[model samples]
Target chain A: MSGFDVGGRLKQLRMQRDLSQRELAKRAGVTNSTISLIEQNSVSPSVSSLKKILDALPVTISEFFAGEEVSREQVFYRASELTEIGDGVLSWRLIGARRPNRRMSILHERYPPGADTGEDMLEHDGEEGGVIISGTIELTVNGEVQLLTAGDAYYFDSRLPHRFRNVSDSECIIVSANNPPSFSDGGDAQHHA
Target chain B: MSGFDVGGRLKQLRMQRDLSQRELAKRAGVTNSTISLIEQNSVSPSVSSLKKILDALPVTISEFFAGEEVSREQVFYRASELTEIGDGVLSWRLIGARRPNRRMSILHERYPPGADTGEDMLEHDGEEGGVIISGTIELTVNGEVQLLTAGDAYYFDSRLPHRFRNVSDSECIIVSANNPPSFSDGGDAQHHA
Candidate 1:
């Protein structure tokens, strides 16, 4: 999905140039039926055949093959398909779990009532941020407690001890992301309280 | 906003350990009035004062001030507040524009009918990925054409010549992210045509 179907692309370019199959054949000095076979993908053209074909269209080989060998990386995810991370009282559904070499981790997080991370002693020392989409959460970072509701957000360096608690009865949802992906290997200095 | 309110945290910590003001002052060999003054933020506690106070609670100075100097970065964004980027036929709403040292850029893109980037020859050689949210887009990358509709997605190296055309009459919307942010500086190789 990243690059073109060579035969189909050739046909499209020829059409854009207003050249008929026979006209292109004559222009490329190839057999008239050669165009037919190539456009239909019935035959894979050789390199020289590609060169001659592209040359007749006045297109560069590099331009034609710029990303031909590259395959499409999956880029879409359904809510049901998001990979669930961590089995704590909260839920963290990670976006693009299959993406190769992602520089960040975006998650749809849900904090239910009675969810108190402070008691568990989970301190992830990475930069973390998020937008609270619904409900309220009491976020404590380095012992500073702030009650943030919907539309409120705070970002901070994570070297400090941090924890979250949903004092409300409703579930709190937040779209959060972390740099360097802190949840994958448990944590740097992991200890359960 | 990143660190604790010294007065509040002290009070909370004291309460957590079941120590009254007189009890803590007796434990730290300090005057009981000093605890009350500090707890009320009536005076900023000196370093030695903090050490004595923390000692009474059996908490380390490092643990208390781990990220105290670090200021909280803006962590939450409202949908109505996303910065608008680009003045093309498409609308790109950038998320977290105020975030310092951002590693990635997330955008909500909308392509109106007649919007086309091919005729403009706008090619950026960066990795780009997006999910189509609504309508449809005729995406041609290195001569490969794919019509992506809602729920479909694609990720590709932008080294290939790529152009987007909203072939459908309705507007198309997509949620996309890019690394290193390509739209700035009018692209790597700037040519109008």
Candidate 2:
């Protein structure tokens, strides 16, 4: 994923979870400045650091690495240039480099074995569509738990409370899209309505 | 752009244009069966044919080629793979192939001499944001016309009628995005409120 794009995604995710920067920092076991810098793309988090944050968000690192895009023409991106977001077990990558203002942000997410969004469910506005690329995910939405395997797709209103966990021993990979980019750097919190 | 995501995009664009398989085939001067096959992903449009159809839509061929995800680490696309969408008069590519579910879709549009939307201004829902990658674009939103050159940016409500035309002799590329993935495959039309 584009680093520039990650700022928006991070903001979106944070908002979806109704997390203030300070709140997220406190829960993720990180400093407010660390989250702020990471969200601003000023500092790229180490895999371990990212994992801790995802652990706090309850998102897995493996699920964070998967992202996607479709271009009119073929373009090339190098591995060294992958846009990394979140913590280790819940790291993510934006698929394209030069994408500017894309309507939707796709993400490749890696959920480590036993890692999850924790006991808390997350709810937000807009719509969410996702497909499990690999492994197994135990999804609880609106008080119902659904176990999804590879190739399974689920779409729901983001406003509904939800949580994801990996019950399998192996890791899980999921390809997902949010109607609005959700991740953001901790900036302009007071400015948000 | 990620090829894996193209299936949804093709469906979305066809819907947004409000052109059916038969209608699109008629507009592109192709057989209806061919359109059906392509939409189904049963057949890939050749360079020339794809270009002709996209030109009718006024989208550049580069978009078709540029939006594909190749691997887990980085995006790798080649120039040779660019699908020609415009008639050498305008070119465009979609960014954020990995993050198709983003709030807006970003497009890299190149306008050649005398290229324009060739229709009345368009008014739609959502917000439009763009940056001029190079050259110039004569943009008319409602009754207001603005000349945008490289490094210039624009943001506007899409509900205002808008159109873009290249008044310069050289090609102009624009990086643009709109929220809510406004383009659709006409599936929504079938629903009755």
- lDDT per residue, candidate 1, B1-193, as tens digits? 1124667767866886789999999988788898898777676664456657777775544334322344456544556676776577777766666654444456667789977875644565345556565799888776777888865566556555678889999999766655434444233513211
Per-residue lDDT of model 2, residues A1-193, tens digit only: 2222444555667788999888988997888887787778665564346556667777543234323232232122233344566466666554342344333444556788887776767764444555565688888777777888764555555556778889999988765555444443332111100
Worst 10 residues of 2 chain A by lDDT: A184-193
**For every candidate, C-alpha RMSD to the true structure in Å:** 23.0, 25.9
- The list of candidate 2 runs beyond 4 A from truth reads A1-76, A96-102, A185-193, B1-193
Error of 2 at A46 (Å): 48
Q: What is the C-alpha lDDT of each candidate?
A: 0.63, 0.55
Looking at model 1 chain A, which ten-residue stretch has the lowest summed lDDT?
A: A184-193
What DockQ, on C-alphas, does every prediction get? 0.08, 0.03
The residue ranges of model 1 lying beyond 4 angstroms of the native Cα positions read A1-72, A78-80, A86-89, A112-126, A131-155, A164-173, A183-193, B1-72, B76-81, B86-89, B108-176, B181-193
Q: Which CAPRI quality tier does the interface of model 2 achieve? A: incorrect
Model 1 per-residue lDDT at B163: 80
